[model samples]
Target: MSNVYIDQFPAEAKVIRAAFYSSFLALALGGVFGIIQTLHRTDFLRFMDSVDYYTVLTAHGVFLVISFTIFFLVGIFTWAVTTSLDRGLEDIRFTWGWYSLMAIGITMTGVAILAGFTDAIDMSASVLFTFYAPLQAHPLFYLGLVLFVVGTWVAGVDWFRSWWAWKAENPDERIPLPTFMVLTTMLMWYIATLGVAAAILLFLLPWSLGLIETVNPLLTRTLFWFFGHPVVYFWLMPAYMMWYVMLPKFSGGKLFSDPLARVVFVLFLILSVPTGIHHQYLDPGIAEGFKFIAMTNTMFLLLPSLLTAFTVVASMEHGARQRGGEGYFGWLKALPWRDPVFTGMALAGLMFAAAGFSGMINAGMNINYLVHNTFWVVGHFHLTVGTAVALTFMAVTYWFLPQVTGKALWSRSVALGQVVVWFVGMTFMSNAMHRAGLLGVPRRTAEPQYEGFEFQAAVGSIGELDAQIALGGVLLTISLGMFFANVVGTALNGRSDDLPANEYAGALSGPDDAPLVLDNLKLWTAIAVVLVIFAYTFPLLSIIDRGGLFGPEVIPFPLTVESATTLGFALETAASTSFESAGEIATSALTAVMR
Candidate 1:
């Protein structure tokens, strides 16, 4: 048996594997919670109770959204950055320390949720995972949040340290394309999270502990969204990197433009950070002008997303066309549909980006009125984050499973079937959710009721979608279980082998055909930052009204502004429908907060 030690490939790969397992295991747990929670709420199952539902919700949010996505991204970035640098991981101790801290943090948070202490601090905020103001959970939740963030930060530092040391050892060098992209992302993450982290640790934590008289809820919300929005990209960047750098090779072609990928990363880093105020479109405390600016800026972040979409598609198309595929759709047919890495990334990317197109509406000042906090938001994110982002993780896992454990997957067909079912189920389910939102079905409520027949009909239709989604979820969950079993079994029982050499490798710099503009991130990053500054400046400044951050008793801002004043503003707050009684859509906002 070939002995592929932990450091055989870069320690980064091991870290990536560790991260993958961590996220995957956590996600499996989250999925179990989600399935149970969804079923209990819908009456699809009668076994669970309110306490179980809430606990599952807490676990799902904390683990799936908070833990899985971030941890997976960290590991992938580590692999990409170190591999690009052609070096082993720079600091083994730091890597292990970061991993251990994250594991401890996640475990602590999970245990805390199970112990029923979440509502101790502020019972009202226990309003399902988003933890919006007026409702409060125990201080343990906030502490858990802090610990998770710290764990992530430690990992982020390790990433930076490795890349920096590599650069220092080779002074006169341009950063490798993949490593450069990751570094810029982490830099943006550091800058972006600072506000929310401060708001949480200094304000929310203390307030929850009864250590402070009150926290500025409005300010906290604003800061939270600011970090919240860009965090999606933080989860997504490695997937993008893998798509640009590795997918093409797996499909038998070179990356079309190394530098263009760099530009996209840098652009996302800067523009994605400050445009979070778009989430506050429905809130009153923020000024109209500030909201307008943030809305405008949100549109700008789409450019980089579009650019990446185009670049990755082009690369994939080129690979397809090269493989004896001819005309338009022919290239699609020629794609390596059987290869886990290539097909999985391509399908996931397309669907996620397609779903993300709705972001334009969500970001728009007028359109958001139609569907904010409704199933539309739910549908959009499931496609983008749930489908697209999660699929990437799956693809990477499948691609590298053998290398990490030195065994073939238990069943390739099972893996492929899982991907297909997920795509199909997500499409139908999200579409129904969007339709339900049009029917004014609010999110976060256990059930929805309406007076009109049309509304009832819509609700009836939603049942079908929900059923389909439940089925899809079941299939996906089963697939995940099989995957975990395969990996574990392989690790334990499979013969050992040397980890494969880096297969889809790219050079630090592109060939002579590379465009000059693609090589530099500074310009794109600057443009993105400027765009964000323009977006968030006014909104943030608007928070300091005289009375305090809340409203009326605190400030001169009108409690009721004319709809005309809202001009491009989307949703009408005055006529907002509430679910005071059971069986109607819940009014609380679900934080699309997780990246």
Candidate 2:
């Protein structure tokens, strides 16, 4: 029998393959919108008026971040849990149930967003991914997100239960490293999602349905970001999983430090949630002390990624050395450069190193003034989430697809070419975006240039920068095409009777070298929750005390001047109602005195 995943565990392989396909569908959709956006914004092309830009932007963010990312996570985490435990899922029916629920949620949310382009639908939600409240989206949008979040929660539970079952059979063995990573990440996920749950269920959903008249913008924003920052970590940890478990093996060596890897995940679980306030440093309503705490935590959070860089690089170096390579950096040339999996992941990590410096500037409370909401911010995240997570996922597909299908790779050369194209394309686009941002280019705008100011570059004209951006987008779009073609072709034609068995590289240092405390997930979960309460309690209270949960409401700003001016006029009137009420009472008292 073939030692591939499909031969060893066919049912689990099917589930994983299904989830991956769903994720790829989202990627394809997101890529279409991504190209359209880059072209339209750069004035390279225009298929729709500027009014529709927000709609497209909303789709791109939601589809890629929520759908593409989480679905891949579900698949990969499922694979990790199953492969590490050496067991099939406890119940195939329950497994399929969660997948179905996720599909429905994504469909519902996507429909609500796509509706924005048409006048035919009475419902539309162009509110963008932040979904900043007081800027209402259709109720279905929130409803859809609610289902999605719940589905993921259940999926996490499924993993936990599987782990529990494994323990009963081998009660003395420490939890496997891959299984430990999944459990800890899921624990953090449950803690992180509470903020968004409260935001949608209690606030945005009701307000959108007209059950409530107004919402506190600060509170909603705080809640959104409470979920937001931690969510970034959630996206990243799976990519980290591949780095720790899969990458060294692909490089032809073992993982360097098992114990340090556990510590890195534990640090993320504790640090990720408490640091959300750094995102709000520029907003006036929040106090500075809170911002300082968040900034401190944010800086501390950098330790793990730095540790990761050192560990991953060291592990790869070991691989090269094992292959009879020598010297400080000369061993880098001995790596499996032709392997798409290794190259894609290595380049993604390289981009992440660049992203880290920019992210530090964003996290620093004082320095935030320089890059907040600028293309610099966008560029920073694209390098991290866009490349680090995304490229890693794409690269993983190159290795993982074959395991489930019992297939030889379609063309190693084609896969290598695709990853290189992605790296080169993103370098052009992200570098231009970073430079444009330093020049104060506002992001999320249909047209970046304004008549009042001319954007002069140190090295080139603004027009030239736009050309670079457009060219990069074109290249990225082409890369996506090549990737899709390779994957689809492999899926169809990649069967081989001689496929190798599924395996991860063993660590040079084993889990026995690590302290047992690392496996104490219950204790870690408790600490994570405590940190979250400490981080959010006062900030949330201040928002609610200054404004009630529902009111002392502020009108949402119109996205465009051409939007209903009448709505703004009405908001101005309603906002002055308290003053009018006080004046009416004073006038009545004065009239009585005269009498």
Each candidate: RMSD to true structure? 8.6, 5.3
Q: What is the C-alpha local distance difference test score of each model?
A: 0.69, 0.89
Q: How many Å off is the CA of 485 in candidate 2?
A: 0.1
Candidate of highest TM-score:
2
* Top candidate (lDDT): 2
Runs in model 2 deviating more than 4 A are 554-595
Candidate 1 per-residue lDDT, tens place, 32-135, comes to 87777666655577585453455566677767877888888877777676667767776787888888778777776666666653434323223355555434
Least accurate 10 contiguous residues by lDDT in model 2: 555-564
Residue 212 CA displacement from its true place in model 2, Å: 1.0
lDDT of 2 at 209: 79
